[model samples]
Target: MQRNPISRRAEAIHPSAVAEMLAMGRKMEAEGIKVYRLVQGEPDFDVPENIREAAKRALDEGYTHYTPNQGMPILREAVADKLERVNRIKAKPESEIIITNGGTLGLYLAVMATVDPGDEVIVLAPYFGPYANMVSLAGGILVEIPMVKSGSHYSPDLDRLSEAVSPRTKVIMINTPSNPSGSVMTRAELLAIGEMACRHDLYIIADEVYERMVFDGHEHVSIASLSEEIKERTITVNSFSKTYAMTGMRLGYNVANPSITKAMSKIYQVSARCAAASTQIAGIEALRGPQTEVERMISRYAERRLMAYKRLSRIKGLHCCMPEGTFYYWLDMTSFGMNSWEIAKYILSEAHVLVTPGSYFGGAGDGFVRLSFATSEENLLAGIDALGDALSRLQPTSGRS
Candidate 1:
């Protein structure tokens, strides 16, 4: 019998839907077709001037070599300070935090460090697309608990979540100011989850990369800061990509207890060794630098959010709640009688606009689509205008009103 070359593990994972859509947009652009891309979650701004200057200074000062497998001590101190001041999570720079190649790597490391084969991981459905893949890569079964929708926001059903916990459960993965959905978990919700984790002796992987992108007076709470017992079991992952417009920098970190940090560092030392030395230097400045630029960027996003929401809500057969946080609007597209993939492809072909199919996130995302407002106001308006035109031609199969 001939053996297949690819491992089952490798074949089980789906290709990134965001990357595929981005590639399609690029291909269309190359063919002289204009494509208005709203598929990715990337901020379209440049790295803050101060942080860029810090990187250039590091290069001039001859800081090119890898400092340590864990990361530079100065950078860790800055991260610790930020955590304490902003997140209210008192993490020790010396033993609790380990810088990784990026937030994606930080999440992967946390899963690998804690989950064993056959262990079950509970995740909120319609989560960040990568969470499913990461759990699968760790040889864990992903058990999704769908968030209940109320008005325009999605929230965890605490009773359902509590019922889903089992003896085989090992980790509960959460993302806030969630990707795709843009629901920032409230403090009451965080406290309940933290208490639940303590009761079940489960590890909590909190992805707070979008912590700073909240809007409409919604607060971003770090679950680990709720209590000492909760903090002990939580491995909080964050990155510079979303917060500081440093996506290309590939810098992020994880804060966990000493034991979990040690396990993650062991994997990091062999795989990535360390993030770029200069990137680490820049991250220090991002944490400690003046906040005027950050404030300006977020303020701009708020204005774009309002503009996009007003435009999107006016379209026929579409329903969207104002996003509470993050830069995305999770749209209910079921009224058009098309699945997410069909809707996305139709928009791409007819309107020359790119959107992420909601089904890419999970089974719960089947009839929805996500639109990002991370680009300029002109692009945002133009893309939505084209989208509105495309959507107007469709006849509704279901009555949403």
Candidate 2:
């Protein structure tokens, strides 16, 4: 008898590069290898006590029923208020916010709501890996525009971006305090992007999961905050996972115009229905409660960022940019004349350090690797030392400066 075949969509997707590295690490651990895990993006911190208490209280009060398709009204309002206060953008609580399982879901839903088959979605290169896959799953084509590197900063090449736009362009996805590179777009960049979206009538999906994780005195400017016209065309995606260290809770929301939010709500209703009731309550407390914990976490990340940059810079042939935000350091390894996968495998096998290969993000990410600093300071330092040792082995004759 013939076996059932998987859908084209499922077959077309490749295994996640981060997940592959994680599995490799786990396999090494099973063999008693001391693996220094710097691949995954999960924060090592615990959820704040206040938010945990809120979830516990909600459970105690039996608030486990299904909520509105959009989300709990109170949590929706809180999210809207957060936009107004933190992002300086106004959104209607009842119509503009829809909470999903996490920011990943929000991104998928936004794509589903806006993109059609063969539609073009421009994504910045060295972006989060899943963005391209998500676009493909949504039946859209991803157009990558590489960001130009200036010393440590990554800025959009507006000229190239302009050339990429066309009548078929439906969306432009952006991540601030970007995932792999940790580069934040400036206000001027945001304005230029907004103007392009407006000119092309393209929707903008702004993933700001690291909005609160900036370092070195760099500020995050939301594209939606640029103007009301831009806000209408932009869907701002965020999550409690990064900000509140509640990754497992899987609670996230999107802010957009009422029409777009309504469409996303329909998709949510048909698929997820609503996020966890208790988690939504937890999210409310996270947004409304004391923000000291968030501030403390940011400070710790900043310190780790500095430590990683200092140590990684000491590597013989590897060049890393000082990230302005997020907990990752993107390293250019082209000088070693090896692709990301080769370098990643070399490090994993020779040094027992697992990192994400940049090729997983897109074509332009071929010669880079991304290391996460979301672990303890001690572990980060140890991983950097291991990486340096591995680089020496790769280029034994290249003397260190």
Candidate 3:
């Protein structure tokens, strides 16, 4: 039998670095290594009880059939209401929202609906890895604009961003409470970006999966809420995975203009049919039911963030900025005279701690490594202690002298 050739798109996509690290950690754990995993960006908590109950009730009621391509009307309306309540933006439920399998799928669908062949999509580095690969898959050029790092907070350079936009530029992808860095874009930054998007006639794909996970009195600003024009041009993507600890539920939705939503729904209908019915029901409950669970989870993550930051700061030659949001702490390893990949591998081998290499995000990430504080406090403290011991051995001469 002859093996079929893989498509170019399939060939273009690289296996996720986070997945690779997690797999390695699992192998080591299987072999009796006590691995402290800080790689994947998943919440350790269970799905909120109210959301789970909604899914259970749906199952018991036999609501297991396929729903509309755009999602259930109730879920869509609830999502729109959420946007209004949380972000202060008015969205039409029927024509402006498309439920997706996850925030990842929402991003892909947004790109597919907006990008033409050879069109340029501007992304800020260090971005989520899949953004570049997805652009390639959709036949769009991925134009990267590096973010300026000020300690731990990352701000998009508006001048550089303006330079990256040309007539061919179709979309700009923005991820706030960003993965790997946990940097939340300020309102002023969002306003600047919104102005650029309006001036350039470009669409903004705002990835707000970590909206509810902010810290230290920082606010998550939606670029779409900056103005009417920005709202018309922005596609805001959010998910239940991050906020509700419903990663396996595969439920998310996109808010955009009616035309864009229609186009995305067309792609969704052809490619995925619809998001899972039970998941959609769960999502509706997630939005409409009590939000106390989300607040509780955020509170716990905030505590973990503080614990991790304090521990990481004490390590010699390593610099960590207090993350304003999310469960990730980006550590600068430039002083270690090692690249992120080398540092990551060393930590795994010597300290039995798993982390994501920053280079996997982009070239700008070379001197950095990402640690997720999604585990229990005990594990977090233990992992930091192990890391401290490893770093001490590596830098003992300085103290000895």
TM-score of each: 0.98, 0.98, 0.97
Error of 2 at 47 (Å): 0.4
lDDT of 3 at 303: 89
- Regions of model 3 farther than 4 Å from truth: 395-401
Candidate 1, clashing residue pairs? none
Model 2 scores what on Cα lDDT? 0.91
What overall lDDT goes with each candidate model? 0.92, 0.91, 0.89
What's every prediction's RMSD, in angstroms? 1.4, 1.5, 2.1
Best candidate, lDDT: 1
Clashes of 3: 0
The lDDT ranking, best first, is 1, 2, 3
Per-residue lDDT tens digits for candidate 1, residues 1-401, read: 77768887898898988888888889999999999988889999999999999999999999899879889999999999999999999999999999987999999999999999899999998998888888888899999999999987889989999999989999999999888898999999989999999999999999999999898789999999999999999999999998899999999999999999999999998888899999999999999999899999999999999999889989988989888899999999999989998999898888898999999889999888899999989988999999999988999788882
- Evaluate model 3: give its TM-score: 0.97
Candidate 1: stretches off by over 4 Å: 1-4
Tally clashes: model 1: 0
Cα deviation of 203 in candidate 3 (Å)?
A: 0.8
Q: For residues 182-231, could you state the per-residue lDDT of candidate 2 as single tens digits?
A: 99999999999999999889999999999999877799999999998999
Cα lDDT for residue 139, candidate 1: 93
